[model samples]
Target chain A: MVRLLRFLVEPLVLPRWWQDALLLLPRLVCGYLLAFEFGAVKFGLPWSPPDHSLGLFEVAFWFPGDVASYGGLFAVLPGFFAWMGAFSEAVGGLLLALGLGTRVSAFLIICTMLVAIFMQQIQQGMWNTLPAAGFLWAALPGLVLGSGRFGLDYILAKPRRHEHV
Target chain B: MNTSRLSLWLSLGFLLPACVQPAHNKTVVYLLDVRGIPNVQQVGLRGRDNPLSWDQDLPLTPVGNDSSLYRTVVTTRTGYLVTEVKFTVNGEFELQQADNRRIAFGAPGDTVVYRARFNVAGSLKP
Candidate 1:
């Protein structure tokens, strides 16, 4: 269990503090947009707009149908995928912003962004695909490098004096 | 585990169950036939109810390959007996002199289909 926890919380160390700080900027911006704007509109979250009338964790009614329209596997279990996609953008993005479980959150965001770019926006032209593409790029760093120095992962993973390294 | 880790796990446990949707006894299927409108790029519905705010437009999906017909499904908790709705084409609400179209819900589990044409007053086929 300890070993598993270590794997989940571990972050990639950078050579310089400025390098970690530079990566943190895009992560923060992208995470905020995903959780508050894109995700909250389709998925239920505490900060969702009042006009949407979404209860906590209840996805918008139109979302599952939209996902199913992608066809094939999405059609087979639209509800599950819709929920997952929404959760990734909403909760996972929040985790990304907080630098908690950074890799897992990045992985989920990457999957959703890929589908958004390929399955949905590809036909709509390059302009429509830009937003998803931007998100994908931002998440790629988190997936590879985890949160680095300025994240909750680093703080949590600090070696405690009671435990031998 | 430390206090922070335990609290994090406990918070996630509580949040997971909240994803279960509430039971909805009423279902409303709104259909808008925009055959008369030329070059309709978008169709949306705004209404007076939960999930359907007058201030926000809920976009409708085109039905199959038929660009003229758009549809959306709304599920609500029981006791929503009636609602007022207005259709929009390209973000402009129907400019009807008459009041907004009214939709009366049937019994629980019964699907109510409200069909109307764009900008045409008294054209609703309930």
Candidate 2:
């Protein structure tokens, strides 16, 4: 069991360079894709070309309805939560990619992923959960490791370290 | 296989923002007692699990011999959440309350593959 757990988290054991590359690279891909490409149609610039259907600053009507249907606190203010979720996927994804407020952004991503898991992914099956799960897994390390040495978090923190010298 | 699956999911991800509905597992509703219904052209399903909302009502196609069973696999994110469904038969008659409407997958990795068999009875048209 311990070995299994290690296998799951073993990616963290890589050398500094490898870890930094892993951290920076995946964050770039996942965050950028989620923000500008994947999530943009739903949450950003409202672009719907002749053949496409996309919107901006608008959570699809069905999203809140689905959240409300999930019941619990989600039923109370589904719109607020829906907006938050969408924003996190869009703006938060950008911040996360940039390593700005690395831990905080990761935390937000974590919350969105939790919803994706229990609220959405759980129902859709594992296949549907992969994107959420991938983000969740990627964000966990970011939350713990501060987005690695290559990230803005490090660049910002670097000056502080030199201040003592 | 993994690569193909991953690409498919990525494509789905791109499409998801425009269609921001809850994730739902595929559910097959074997609507019983649909035989007596007159001119059953199409069957649709809606439910509380869907928060009694969702613009599109899932259509149930006729399956098996004699059209006795209308088959439609619905999708939802929750596994055990009881989906109270009402079936609109022939675009007129309404059949509410169904059994096994809980849409669930066999395991975590198989979200697209649902193992739920919803055998709902028409239970008299109102």
Candidate 3:
């Protein structure tokens, strides 16, 4: 457990500037893609396509209800659980992009991708799993690393608290 | 951070149940949603069933009091089959879930009931 924790927070051996730039690339692209593109369609935002009526705070309930179609404990309160999953993806994705609440947002993304990978994608095929797995890997580091120096998380953090990263 | 971690753990605790969708061996009933459509003419289910192409659609029957819920029952020869519902709600044909919904009719000879839901607020895709 201690070794796992150490690996999670292990500082990069590279110079601070290089480390910041490397992490910044994924942090920006993945965050923007999830927040601006996919989440908008499913959860709704100013830029959400005008065609579908899925509005902010609403979920694509059919997916959760689909989960319930399993016909077991999954059938109970499927809507509520579904809403939580959607919320994590849409809202959490946005936060991840902005690097606000970095740890928390990363945690949410981790859970959502875990389900996407294990529950849905594994059954489909490797191509389907690859994209989610990419985000999953990116978010995994963010879960422990938090947002790096180039993000809002850095500015919001206090002095001498570099350890937070 | 401690509060946030606790909440994350709590959220995981609640979400754990959504992960248990095992394949069941049963003759399953799939209930699709046709609720709250502003105007309607007709509705049906379409997909790999009946015909490989979605050219043909299966009709849905309404349940008591709720005009929105529609249902259908099926037994399986094949393993896992996916499908979508098409509503001729207002002259134009609209499909549910962008046709993303699916069903596992379970293993042959088992019986169970499952529900699927979809809603279109206004206007169908062109």
Candidate 4:
């Protein structure tokens, strides 16, 4: 049993760089699809106000800091949170695609998704919840798997040197 | 493939700012069903820095007896119910009537909610 298991799994052990490349493919594809799918809709541009088609709950994360309706505690809270989230998903997804800053990008994506989940759960019964849930489901595993197999990180693999006599 | 991914991200970074711009104020519309009667409410500009303050309510323009569709314009300092901003029901759904109307606010990201009581019914045209 040991021999069989080793034979089946041993060849799969890839160098760190290759591991990263392998990880990059799916991340990049899925990230692009999500971005494109969301971007295609005429929701609103990144810097401006949201549309009514999007409920306050939907655009909860994107609300800007400097532009609060009432000036109490949550004044800039929504906007700042949204700003961070948009940048993360947009840039983080892109980075994941490139495998350039895989860890950082994945971290940001994860954070954004978490915020999204929080908003959805708090708000409750919003259509936006599904996408957030879906992304989170896919992203956690991707984060664990990481960029592997055939990524740039693979090229940067440490060179093996011969020991001097 | 790795190089391709790198290029894709680099290009996206350059394009992001162009795709997003700050709104003069926030624009939010709610197809709310208060009790059984439907009401369309439009919040003009959500303002720049305050969420609570941005909750300023605009006039509820009655579009139909259903009240699911209305129109208004809003901003931080001022709001015009008819002029700058306009409102109309995109469409209403019987099946989704149970589901709330969805809208986006503040920044343009993928977020939408279906208000429980409120339902989008009919078309904006009529």
What's each prediction's TM-score? 0.62, 0.48, 0.52, 0.41
Candidate 1, residues A39-102, lDDT tens digits: the string is 9877788898765557888876667767889999888667777888999999888999989999
For candidate 4, report its TM-score.
0.41
- Candidate 3 clashing pairs? B25-B107, B26-B110, B27-B110
Best by the DockQ measure: 1
Q: Which candidate would rank higher by DockQ, 2 or 4?
A: 4
Number of the top TM-score candidate: 1
DockQ, every prediction: 0.10, 0.05, 0.04, 0.06
List model 4 lDDT by residue over A13-40, tens digit each: 2456565455555676757754444421
Model 2 misplaced stretches (Cα beyond 4 Å): A1-15, A45-58, A160-162, B1-126
lDDT of 2 by residue, A63-140 (tens): 666667778877866766776687777777887788776677778888998997888777877788887888988777
Instruction: Give every candidate's TM-score on chain A.
Output: 0.96, 0.76, 0.79, 0.55
lDDT of 3 by residue, B11-61 (tens): 765764344223323355656566666564555655553332366555666
Give the DockQ of candidate 1.
Answer: 0.10
Q: Judging by lDDT against the true structure, name the best candidate.
A: 1
Question: Deviation in angstroms for A9 in model 4?
Answer: 23
lDDT of 1 by residue, B1-126 (tens): 999999986665455434634335677898888887888888899987667888888999998886788999987663335667899888888955769887777776788887778877654755
Model 3 residue runs over 4 Å out of place are A1-14, A70-73, A160-165, B1-126
Q: Could you tell me the lDDT of residue A114 within candidate 1?
A: 96
- Native A-B contact fraction in model 2: 0.08
Sort order, DockQ high to low: 1, 4, 2, 3
Better of 1 and 4 by DockQ: 1
